[model samples]
Target: MSATPSSKLPPFDPRDPLGLDDLLTDEDRAVRDTVRQWTADRVLPHIAQWYEDGELPGIRELARELGALGALGMSLTGYGCAGASAVQYGLACLELEAADSGIRSLVSVQGSLAMYAIRRFGSEEQKQQWLPRMAAGEVIGCFGLTEPDHGSDPAGMRTYAKRDGGGDWVLNGRKMWITNGSVAGVAVVWAQTDDGIRGFVVPTDTPGFTAPEITHKWSLRASVTSELVLDDVRLPAAAVLPEAKGLGGPLGCLSHARYGIVWGSMGAARTCFETALDYARTREQFGRPIGGFQLTQAKLADMAVELHKGILLAHHLGLRMDAGRLRPEQVSFGKLNNVREAIEICRTARTILGANGISLEYPVMRHATNLESVLTYEGTVEMHQLVLGKALTGGLDAFR
Candidate 1:
């Protein structure tokens, strides 16, 4: 199925009847409308089958289209990027995730994690090598940070890279829970250097570099996740990202990824909320519309309230980021609050369907399950708390 001929993409119709425009700037609205149109055309019509098949075949091509629209790395400046405002990026995220969190995961990892990592840390040569292909979706990239034993505490990561003679390096370690690992043509891997932790751009074909797809996962099934095993992989000095140093380097990338999650999760919540609302309005209870009752209204009301607040929080944080005053802890704050609220919204929306919620005919259950992964990854719930606690008390005690 193709998108309706309508050039606009607000729910069911365009023209701002819902007044969501009040939440967006003109630029943000334009970006959102474009992505929403793309998703409706490319994703929604085919998603149920893809969801059933457990894979989205068009993801890579869809990513390239997003890149052309400047949706990929839109917030980043220069190097063939959109360089748009962070608020606009947030709106793009919302529209993409409104389609599915798994697809949104692809965008966030490519744009925020992979592209941002290279742009922020890599040497000029490395950026020139990867950023252009990535922005064009010609080469997919994944961030390899969490290890088998270091999901919650990456500093404890055992992956190590040692400098050999002639500016060459040998890397050995396993990276766990890597998104896009299976399909990525490039991987941004962090390893412990003799001096400290450092990041590397390891091509997937590097000898001894292998990523085995993780299968039968209940969460984020439509997205690819894999374990990257680096068995004495060799790299040139150019592999090292020059500007990023210390723990802040990888953590900085996580902060960028989390900001995208803040917006993306709201899209997931909105989908489930809307599904539940429509169900309530049509699914008869005692020969009366469930939506007419106070109980169903209460659930819809809560979902709306939470989704609205999450979007506002993400939108405000986007402004701060554009101002260059946003702190890592602030990113953590949005990641923590919005994801939690979105998960709750999904759960409540799922309950509105009674038994039908668990069925694939509805998206609430899938969104809820995927939200579980969203909450756990990208500096888990407790880790964000530690970050926020440190911000206030100057103490980073909890996740260390």
Candidate 2:
């Protein structure tokens, strides 16, 4: 008997063993294919080099291209946004992270964090001034919430905004580990105020505002990270985001980004699993393919099972978000499970690749390294665990 292209070996499904594609609408599939093709054409070929160089060259150009594709702020309504469904946005994230987590971070910060802040809470004037250009990619934005001393504990932030006698605002603070910080045209900075924690739209070129690039990071190397310094940067009263106040403001934006990560992590896992499967089929050991052995088969089977399950979880969360019924704890549930499993899948794939897995020639090691950052940011694994713990225990406060 001979093998046919359609029936070759175990029947490749791109790690989607449950036929989940049938659940997606036509528009959803279209969105996924568009992003997948765009990443293949624009990102994958150059990503390894970009990762090695520790910088994303032509980032502004890339932003503009993403805008043209209606990918930036794709799920938002109006202001030149694509106004696509939440599922479409999740699909887009999956495709982007399949290429590189840094690429997905770029989109997530722009659409989910920066643009979402302005859209959800900005005053009409603020939205009229920024969101259109940002959606079009002519203007870039960064979210400033985390500080040099504050990560999970944003309430302890020292960044402060004071009101002058003339009613103008003066902001003084430093925000650390901000993605797209140095390259942004505008920054949505959150500062402690007499009223509470408040968000302000600060132009990046303000006299006392400076975003210096952070150097020598071992993870997310292809993405730009920076420290935002606001040394008495003054702004008009109109710069304030009127609708947002307290810790809930920034936490809301994080919920959006974390939801995207639930899908994006699975994309990285799929890539690693596919790469390993291909290698196992062709790479021989002791005069036979390594995949023929039971141990290798076990590793591959486990990875495939987790990868598909994570994708299903992401899809379910997207549907909830689209229906406006998704909770923050639910997003945490998906993020915690998907990112942890994705990293494990990547590591398992790395072991299957042997020495070659650690090399940049293949993407397994790079995805593994990027997952380390993903596991910590947008709420750490422990943080999510506490979130679920509290939810399950009926208002138990574990972190406190």
Candidate 3:
């Protein structure tokens, strides 16, 4: 049976289906609106070009602009941060990522991983020294946990830090696939120690610290990805983050960033869906708009269902986070479901766009490719599945 196209299509609202917009408080709506407009004005126009060029020029200027908008470290309290609620932070992430995942990646690495580490585990002096500047975007930050040999199994990481005769810490390791690494002023690097895994705040300018840009990437080309090499890098005893011990510290930070991915992935899917919808409404095939075809309509319907549901899940998780009731396993659930579904949505949208979908002019392909990176980062899909499996099995350890 052929589906009949309605004579008049409803106004497109990819991010807000099921009247979810009505549920947002005024502040939440305001936060979403602000980021939406900023992306429309500043990002959407140039993001494709930036992605194609494989670099975002004037990156520092863009960082400052994000700071001025109070986007950097927006959810964290004090230290020149915005102290916005988790929902607002998630909304901002959605808007930014709707423009491009690269943009969202910048904010996530800076705020969720680096800044949050300091705020959650750093001493007052460490926080005072870095958080303010990082929140203001005067100094960019990166988190170093994933290494060349150890990604899924960080416990087996070879990167290690040792105490010198003078009581200073000497770090020796390499971190790979680090976002914002090349541009970072400071790196929150985690390394194995005799006392178990520990995190250290190393200035980029410190002796023996080098961040070499990783090029030729197919995904996240607009973002700065790099390899962090610490060849006997020396840091003061104060540089060690006093509170973060063992794998829990870096895993905690990954949870924070993964939460943002829950929302950001939906944003990317939304862009692809909207773009595909607009194209289907106009492009003709067999003397009718392609959207009039039953097949295309089915694709659109499925994409819409997943996109909206992902947003709803993100909102629920955000509320939990704001209330301090969120759990790591819950975050894992959201990340696994949302990101997996989002990539599916993007791929479906790309099919709806047909051959044009593969082109950067349409944004469908770009978003789809970016989601490839999104799916793997923070926590891989398989890893999250194990987490949920453990949760269901009464804390049974499955990943032996």
Candidate 4:
């Protein structure tokens, strides 16, 4: 059988997907269609309220629904995941983020950061212990690597894990800016061992584990960010992720999360672009719709062009990743370029909308605001610049 119209391949528009490509198999089409409709109906109706409330009220339920749709770690081949291709995973991120970045962050952190770590490094037993529950969203998970003092430089972590009197590991340190921290039942925490940085799975109920909510976030307001305190927190030796050692482990997980950002940010741009297109066609200026004006059309054109480039870039990267040939630097390229361009697109779209852009009634300003966080997190633009710089030059001047 042929692919669906949504894949945007040959017989589909090269410049845009436009739901005309037979690229995605019928199953993928169905998945994309399902998420698109769900986001439009379930999320759009209540998104403004959630945004205003500064919290996702029905997130557990929402997460469970996503799990049912095979969104959690959707690209991973097994472990109750969707077992979708990388493109499908990108599509899922796109749909979620089109609703809101915070919504997408919830899924991305859970799937790419938390679940990918376990799936990549967890033992079969550990996988069996937690994957299914997390996949179902019955239990939530978070990744903790960025400490209060160690933001960009995670390797300088002070969170320490030492072998205890009985062979268990006792952890002590603070993890800040953690997503899903307050609600996570299980957290994949990184800490310094004698062997360098290692990750551990700590149950939130662990005696000394406490995560207090970090409030007043002007960005990603609908998502939860918090501080995780490990005061003599202890875990079994089995809690250790034996498959990984040193910074490579968490960095690997970050590469996964960064891939999602590449698509997710573009999703935000798509929303802004679409909103601006509609506004331009309607809001009267001078004697006709502002879209008639050269300046307005030019702004819309730029948004469209940049959005298309971002989409194609992400799709190409997804193709490479599916083939197991993608690199960290490539991810850095996508994350950095797409977010930077998408943010500009949203800002441009907002400017065309004039005052209405800042209103919650329109999507551009919110996407623009959320893009600020997206630009900084998952390795900042500068970090990715250095990553690419190192790729091009034999010299390593990132930190030095």
Candidate 5:
């Protein structure tokens, strides 16, 4: 059967070649646009300066603003959280990272790691006392799982929490590469105990708790990275998260954070891709726009394909998450693939922009450097590969 062509179909938009926007509902589009506007108004204009200064000045003020926007814990229910769907949270991550990966890291560490730990494992009193303030950004929180000596193998962590004669829990150890550490009012410190591994909700002002800022970092300079030192920090029995036990507790929180990275990395790629595409169209060589050349066109075409494909993959994961069917191995798959591809896109974009790409005046170099950190944090490439490998090989453990 032959069908007549309809003129009602909309013309293809270069920005959305695959018409992926059609997949979003009106509410979803509204959420995405709102975050996009917020980033344009607040983040994009000042990010270069922030990156150059290696400081996120007025970070407390920004936290309050983000809290007002319900971006602190957008997917968590109650406790003043937005209670949004996982897809919406993923969209917010995308928009935030489009401005800077540091910004997205702040949100991920806050909502996915710290808040999720308390919400999922803490006692009711703990949740009631902390979640509201954390969600409102009145108090910022940091997750302490990764140690100076341990990155992938967290079971070897030297940090220990022990019960004293008075039933007080005493902690001692150091955590490295902790985001939101110095500024966080609270720290969720995971430590080895007599029973096993347990999590402690320690106030930053505790007598022996100090978060010293890590300095002179070339990557993620606009973000707060610190080392948490807990020397005999004492807490009441109520401070321990009762529900979580063993290494699974912290690993669960990490899986949630990695899910956000799956989307956030693509956002960085999108910005770089757009920068390259626009530059290719306007920059001229041999008495014509460079985009007129076959080589430039090929780069743009390939970048576009990968960039959108990553977004599609993130969306698929977001859906699975919302449906409560997402597995840790699957999350590892998304994180491994999207972050690797996103970095490649950024490097390719740098080539398209020539020397201008290296300048802070352009975002390409900053994003590229930032993605370098993103590639290793959460879970390194090797870690995720082992995860997928074990899954495929029917539980063949390779980390020995």
Candidate 6:
């Protein structure tokens, strides 16, 4: 006998028109909702003022709250981490970036960059020293890989670490545009060594180590950007991340961070899209709501398609990451497409909201501005394109 068709299906949601919710497990929804509510309660009301003031006041307290929620290092195992799946972490990132890219930058730098570096490459002693505190957000951490003159080309970094007569590592160089740099208790700094590139787990308070906060940023103004100066910073022999040798260590951490951006950028886009949708439905033009116009509908339709498509792409990458089968090239694909698309979505959203879009009263302009920085960081669009090009072309060298 033929089976009868199911009589019920979930009602359509305009916001999530593609019915993407069905793909998430109950646990996923819980994680997403928890983060969403946290951001709604904690970030939404204050973000405008914070963005305007160009500061993230009470950031340490925010970190502690994030830690209490098991979000600081949500995906890593042990050492006080929540050990949730990568997808859960991605969902949390989306929610965080939905509120503000700066907030997500803070978490991404902490968990994906700093903590992951130590967890994946540091010795047991190093892990025992830092991970638990970092995971608990009792100690904030920063990753130092980008230098003033060397961003895409980390191999040419000017930061150098040398062994002194006492066999201690002496670090001297600067890392620029570092997130959480000024507030970080510890910095996982990468520098050139005799052996090759090495990562040092330097305590921020160590003598000769200083992170001076960078001011006057138009993009991601709410985030702390700093220049980490290592003026003959001395460290014990054990300070080096034992397993992290050469460029691969930092690059690996970057891949992980970029994966989060793949999801996080979409979060920013989602917020902008929702804000525009709300405005279009309510704002009247020529005695009719703007939503009634075909032009407005087309804009909304295009935004929805790209937004959901980007979300779907992010989810697919998250699953790949969880399965341990994700490739660097695949990550490049996601970062390249998602960040670019996310920026476009934000821009389109601004157009929908018209003059009000530029106001900090709405999130569209803020997200758009924040995404400009996102577009340049964690491997620029050009770098990702080259990466994908090499992969697709079977190892053709594009960069000379």
Relative to the true structure, how large is the alpha-carbon lDDT of every model? Answer: 0.86, 0.94, 0.93, 0.88, 0.94, 0.94
Give the range where candidate 2 is weakest over 10 consecutive residues by summed lDDT: 7-16
Local lDDT at 229 for model 3:
96
**TM-score for each prediction?**
0.93, 0.97, 0.96, 0.94, 0.98, 0.98
What's model 4's overall lDDT? 0.88
Runs of candidate 1 exceeding 4 Å displacement: 1-20, 394-396
The better-scoring model by TM-score among 1 and 5 is 5
Residue pairs in candidate 4 whose N, alpha carbon or C atoms collide under 3 angstroms: 5-21, 8-21
Candidate 5 Cα outliers beyond 4 Å, as residue runs? 1-8
Higher-scoring candidate on lDDT, 3 or 5: 5
Error of 1 at 380 (Å): 1.2
lDDT for model 6, on a 0 to 1 scale? 0.94
Candidate 6's displacement at residue 192, Å, is: 0.5
lDDT at position 96, candidate 5: 94
Off by over 4 Å in 3: 1-15
Task: Write down the RMSD of all candidates, one decimal each.
Answer: 5.9, 3.4, 3.7, 3.9, 1.1, 1.6
Per residue, candidate 4 scores C-alpha lDDT tens digits across 20-65 of 2445678767877888888998798988777778888887898898
Give the alpha carbon lDDT tens digit for every residue of 196-246 in model 3: 999999999999999999999899989999999999998999999999998
**Residue 172 C-alpha lDDT in model 4:** 96
Candidate 6: TM-score? 0.98
- TM-score, candidate number 4: 0.94
Order the candidates by TM-score, highest first. 5, 6, 2, 3, 4, 1
User: What lDDT would candidate 5 get against the real structure?
Assistant: 0.94
Model 1, range 249-291, lDDT digits (tens) per residue? Answer: 9888888888899999999998988888888889998989999
Residue pairs with backbone overlap in model 2: none
TM-score computed on alpha carbons, candidate 3: 0.96
